[model samples]
Target chain A: MSTIVVFVEHAAGAPRRGSQEALGAASALGATVVAVLCGNGADAAAAQCGKFGAARAVVLDATAWSPDSAAIGVAALVRAEKASAFLASATSSGRDVAPRVAALLDCTLFSDCTALRKDGEKLVVTRPWLAGKLDATLRSSAPVLCATLRRNMFAVKETGGTAAVSKGPALGPGKAVLEKIEARAGGKLDVAEAPVVVSGGRGLKEAPNFALLEDLASAFGNAAVGASRAVVDAGWRPHSEQVGQTGKTVSPQLYIAVGISGAIQHLAGMKTSKVIVAINKDPEAPIFKLADYGIVGDAFEIVPALAQAVRKIKAQG
Target chain B: MKIIACIKRVPTTDLQPRVAADGKSLDAAGVQYMTSFYDEIAVEEAIKQKEKHGGEVTVLTIGSAEASKEVREALAKGADKGVILVDNAWGGRDPLATAKTLAGKITELGADLVLLGRVGTDRDNASVGPMLAALLGWACVTDVVGLELGDGKGTARREADAGTETYAFALPAVITCQKDLNEPRYAGLKGIMAAKKKPLEESPCPPATSQVEIEKLALPPARKAGRIVGEGAAAVPALIDALRNEAKIL
Candidate 1:
């Protein structure tokens, strides 16, 4: 029987949603799922992982081990347990760690996997390649398979199963240290985690003009601000704010593209958004083809009007 | 000072993609390819650093023969030389194995600084650089938007969740350029012509081993058609109602 290890990623005592998604994926494989918790709050993470259907939660309590250290430890655990597969959430931390673990274990790794299944004695994982343009099915030659599940690709359910929490031997000191974390101005929501997003492009014409996108996002109250690759390259916004094949891949509940002529690269990142709205003066813009709701008008004119309209509606409520 | 930049050639993301008949890879029949967006930034950063510090910039890529075009693109953008590691067997290898192969070649080059895009545009794994650093036993900083190098050490700013993190590391490190690191220069006609004369070497390495495999490939389920509740501000109430009740996101 193959055992699956899910690396639990957490910050400030709370586990990320992606961790639960990995747990969900691990469960579907019918493998014994174990959560590997590192850093300070291992106990809390272990408990949460248990609620999410991990059969066992292993706490590698080492103060010196940063998130990166977990990669080495995971490799050690995989060897020690003789686990057949390992799973992780495709977050920044997981992306950093899972590959190193795979390298150390001399195993294959499938990243940003959208689905998984059993193919005879081997596990087959499906993942997007070529910026969501192609889906690839991969099979591992090694008995141990590793994968990182994309966020929001799978539903995380509370299985309510009791997990056995155990403590693993400390892996010793790590090389890296977490010095400090500085919050961005106004503490905007993470683009990867936001439920809604409002993006702009070169069509916005100027930097200050992004206020229109801000207004729409403010109206949504839970939306993050994003930009097309062109806009970001033009220095209209921070690179972290860009949404596209090379930037952040977001699958929000609503993605509003203002003054944006949808480029294929731009569409690859947010095409999975649940509700797509495009506002562009060019009625023939490619964005219109993917938009569930499209408005053909000058973004400069339509944006302010839309903002005022949403403000009035919110005030009424 | 010596610098190395690893780049990749990826399809332009703007085109409609068709899956291969085997359902396990991109058809790549009619698609256009370009240097990945972040790789452009990586090459630009390398050039900028070379200009300021009087160093040499060597761009590296691991792919098939077609990858030479991307190397030529980077050479036109001011890289001093190019190295293309081509192996037919590495066509669909995972990121870890790719990193190992690249790291081996980079280790052979003995660069003082190594640079890469935060992630490939196609894979978007954002892992190879850091993983390479780990494998090479070098300090690694990823998602670097800004960088300043001096006297065998450097400081870099990287994006994180809801914030930014700045770190200082010694030379002989690997850093992945994020989108905002620097604006990449367009290849002028002169540069394009000059690139033909630049020295580019091609070498093949053993295919790195992969442990993770893809099982099946399919397009995500298509979204259902959405109905517009109304138009203008009048539509606001219905939008809110639908968000609260129908979508249940509110």
Candidate 2:
């Protein structure tokens, strides 16, 4: 059977959900699924991989490596894994590193794949574009195939695979350095990772209107607040919270877009969210075309109502 | 100093792209083309760098000769020259293949630095700069909003998972521009006239055979039509019900 390697990404001493999602995607490769990890909690991450689908796991302590250098360092370990197909979650770091791995391996790669399956000894992948209006099916002829998978596309289950753990050598000196990192949001509660996102737009009118969204997000508790490019440009929100062609592309379990008119740019960022609910006064709003549920109304009235309902539900449940 | 900027010719974001007669490709007849938005920022940054650092900025693109329109657009905004790389080998090629071709041209030109859009609007992924950097053995940064050039190094601030991070890179770096990096300038009448006088070069860049290929392209399945559960505050209860019971999200 072909050997598949899944890259496990970690943060603050635990495996990130995307890695588990990647591991879940790798399970269907039906190969000897090997998990590879680096950075702060490689050992812990490897152990976590065991519950997903890993048959074997390798660890490399990459404390000093930046995302750019990590690609080079982990690629060295991946070479030893002899992965016929390599998989990673399509996060910022994962997207940054996967192509470098492919370049190091002298093969081509795919990104943001929503699905992958074997086809007569080859693998075919599917990715979306045009704000999910177009889908592209792709194939690679390279001996080793590598892909960055879309978030939450594959579901993980406890498989009790009992992966055998191993250690890899540390990386030597590298050219690129991490330098300094300034985080806009505290606690790593990134909009990209949140299960639910409450996004606001120009329809919200002013910056204070965001407080209503903050209340709704607080009701969802685990949800993050996002902003469309227009509001962000208007200084209604920070760039970190912006979601559109120029901002973070998110795929959450549920996305509630308040007052977003659904420009192609805005839709391009969040169309992948599994369930979308748009609240807009305009019935012709393009967002409704992409939303799973539509509420035709003003945000000032609808959002407060949503907050009240969500608060009551949370209080009771 | 020699600098290269990679630009892409993409359909205007406002236009709705339709499948051509082939049913697998975007219709070309009425698709208005422009320099990919982020790439325009790259070109603008290159111009600012050239003005301050006494260097020439060469805008490079990989597409049909029709990309000349985008090249002139870049030149009008202040690039010194333009080069279009067209190849039958590169038709429908993926990012990795495109990067390899750009790497070859960058090496051939002996570029001191390279700039590209953080992500091209078409195909919309941000991998080309890093892949090309890997091929060239250079430091690479993406989503860069702040940049400062130095004697042999540069500093850049880019968006990260939670926030933005600042990085120091040695020379010969590949830095991709994000929005807000700079205000891309519009071409004035004089600038447009001068752009027509700028040297535009075109060459057939016979890229290596691509390993990855698109098999088919189709309209994504339409999102299901949704009912307007109710109007205002009264509808909020039904919405909550849908979220909690039907969608099971709550």
Candidate 3:
């Protein structure tokens, strides 16, 4: 059987949910899947890989947060297994790592895959291009293929494969040195990867008015707060909270825009979101044209009531 | 110092992209193009670095003859010169292949610095800059929102999932500009007319080979038409109900 490998994307002390999802997608191909986890104490992460149907889970002693180090480790794994396929979540970090892995193998790396399937000796990947405006089906025939999978596109399930775990080889120091990491704004949840995002804009009128969007995001519990470029430029919010062409690109599961005009720049950042909700008093606001749900009303009255309704619904459970 | 700003001419994304008659590539008829947003930022940043340190900025792109417009835009932004690798070989080339051509050009230029957009809107592959760096055996940083370069070293910052991260690298590094890294200045009439006379070089492109190929292209499933749940605070309960029962995301 051809061996397929999945890279483990880690967070605070553990692999993130997307890591399991990658493994699950690979397993659905009916091939023997090996999950590779690199970094300190990554062995613990391997323990759960078996539950997702991995044939084996291997740990490599690579430095954390270094794509180059992880790619080198994966290169080793590929050589050992002569792996036919590799997969990782298409997160910001994954985007940094997967290409180098492909380059190392002389294979082509495909990104933002919504569907992947194996056909005999080849694999096909479906991806959205130009902001989901179109879909392209890509085929790889390099004997080895590398791809980054989009989040929420696959389901994670327990196959109870019961894989054997072991330690693998590590790579040398990476070229770039990570000097520091600091929180610039918002909180732990980044708008780019958050499952839910609630954003505010100039319509809020003042910095304190942003608290309304915060309340709505708080109601989601897991959502992050975002800001329009106008608000960020006006000093109503930090640049880290800004979402637009010149800001962060996010494709969260749900995105709510409040008191914001939908400039194409801002829409470009979040238009790929699975669900979009827009609230603005201007009936002709361009945001409403793209919103999955829209309400034309003053945010002051509707946001508080919306927050209350969301809280009530969550409390019911 | 010599700086190479690798660039791409991507289609404006606000409108829908149509598949060609072959159903495997983008339709080119009447398609409008501009310098990819991030690459524009890279160009502006490269010019800024040149202003700070004595160096020349050379804008390079692997594209058709039409992409010279993108180069001219970079020239208007203050690049010293421009080169567009024009060849059918570049068509359908994967990120790795694109890196190969770029690395060749950068190497030929005896580069001391390289810059590019983190990702092109068309391919959305934020891979070329780092791939080029790896091929050249140089350090690299991607999605950079902040940067400072001088002497023989550079420092940069970017946002991460948890927070912001800072990195330091030496000269001959490849740095990919993220959006908001710097606001690209507009090309005024004088700058635009000056770009008309700036040297723009074109290189022949040969057929290329890659491990990846596109099989088909199709439109994504259209979003369902939305409905107004209600009006004002009175509609909040209905919206909540729709989210819980219909969308089931909450």
Among all candidates shown, the one with the greatest TM-score: 2
Give stretches of model 3 more than 4 Å off.
A63-65, A184-187, A227-251, A260-274, A284-290, B88-91, B188-190
Across all models, the iRMS values in order are: 3.2, 1.8, 2.1
DockQ by candidate, in order = 0.44, 0.65, 0.62
TM-score of the second chain for every model:
0.96, 0.94, 0.94
Q: How do all the candidates rank in terms of TM-score, highest first?
A: 2, 3, 1
lDDT of 3 by residue, A1-317 (tens): 48888888765655677788898998888878998887777877787788887889888876645666678788779878988888888876777778888777777788878899867768889986775667789888776888888876777878876779898977567777778888645555777667899999989999998888888888878888999988987888877778866566677889889988888768766777888888888878988888888888889999999888888878987
Cα displacement (angstroms), candidate 2, residue B246, comes to 1.7
Candidate 2 positional error at B23, Å: 4.4
Among the numbered candidates, top DockQ falls to 2
Better of 2 and 3 by DockQ: 2
Fill in the DockQ of model 3: 0.62
Q: Lowest-lDDT window of 10 residues in candidate 3 chain A? A: A184-193
Give the better candidate number (1 or 2) by DockQ: 2
How far out, in Å, is residue A67 in model 2? 3.3
What are the models' TM-scores?
0.88, 0.95, 0.93
lDDT of each: 0.78, 0.82, 0.81
